[model samples]
Target: MADALVSIQILPRTPNGESVIPYVDRAIEIIQASGVRYVVGPLETTMEGDFSELLEIVKAMNDEMIRLGAPSVLSQVKISYNPTDGASIDRLIAKYRT
Candidate 1:
């Protein structure tokens, strides 16, 4: 069994007209800081690690964003379980199924 890969896409609408780059940067920073050996989004961040840990890492990142006063932020998070030794696009395919 392989660890689950979680992908979180943040769509933040800042009333202060804040730049989205910083938001994205902050998100990446938080995610990376979680100690999950995974890649970030918009460029297909391929990560490998524990499933539950990844979930916690992602949730924590979102919580941080909300705590930063972006509670109204819109996010699209996706989780996929890729075999440790197999080619899988199940996540991508699953996206359409929904």
Candidate 2:
């Protein structure tokens, strides 16, 4: 069970004022490599996993953005943690998914 749910929308500032599509693509690539249950919305991407792991992923996303030529990044993050029963991406959306 996932101990937390993390949703993030990263806005990486391009050094050359180029389109950020490629940078955003790299961020999503990091998420894909994490192998977590994730949903990519138009504005944000939500993932379910351990808090530490998710946080690490966030760092990796930021690092990758910098390596990809982003001068800075602004991330909007939301977290839901339930240590007892744990939060689930599927369970939370099952009703709507049906």
Candidate 3:
């Protein structure tokens, strides 16, 4: 079981005023590549994993944005952590899915 569920919304400002959708897409790609369980929503993406790994993913996303030409990156993050029983996205929202 995972120790946390992290939801992140990344806002990347391009140097040339380009559309940020591509950058956002790339960030999501990083999440996908991590192989953690995730859910993509309209305003943010949520991932379930170890607390430290999830934080590392956030760092990777910001670093990639800078490498891709973003002068600054703004990230909004929400975390739900349960070190004892652990956290789970499915366990929280399973009732709504039905």
Candidate 4:
């Protein structure tokens, strides 16, 4: 099982001040491609995986924004880490799923 859960919301400043949704979409795409278990909430996207790997993913996400016409980025992150038994996204959200 994954040992950590990371939730992130990246706000990239567009070069021309255009809509940020598209850039945000690209960030989500990164998460989608990561192959980790994730849930896209209204405010942020959460991923469950090894702690260090998840931090690397967050860095990639910010870099992606700069590559995609964003001048700068502001990313908010939250992490829950459990190394021994680990944790599953499913287990955490089970009560709210139904």
Q: List the candidates' TM-scores in order.
A: 0.67, 0.94, 0.97, 0.93
Question: Which parts of model 4 are misplaced by more than 4 Å?
Answer: none
**Between the candidate structures 1 and 3, which one is better when assessed by lDDT?**
3
lDDT of 3 at 32: 98
lDDT of 3 by residue, 1-98 (tens): 89999999999999999899999999999999999999999999999999999999999999999999999999999999999999999999999995
TM-score of 4: 0.93
Instruction: Residues 1-98, candidate 2: write the lDDT tens digits.
Output: 89999999999999989998888888999999999988999999999999999999999999999898888999999999998999998889899974
Q: Name the regions of candidate 3 deviating beyond 4 angstroms.
A: none
Assess candidate 4 and give its lDDT: 0.92
Pairing residues by index, what is the TM-score of model 2? 0.94
Give a tens-digit lDDT track for model 1, residues 8-88: 777667658787677667878876776656655574344445677766766666676777767567777677765565324
Sort every candidate by lDDT, greatest first: 3, 2, 4, 1
TM-score between model 1 and native: 0.67
The number of the candidate with the highest TM-score is: 3
Best-fitting candidate, scored by lDDT: 3
Candidate 1: RMSD to truth: 6.1
| Cα lDDT tens digits for candidate 4, 7-72 | 999999999989999998989999989888789999999999999999999999999999988878
lDDT, model 1: 0.64
Q: Which has the better TM-score: candidate 2, or candidate 3? A: 3
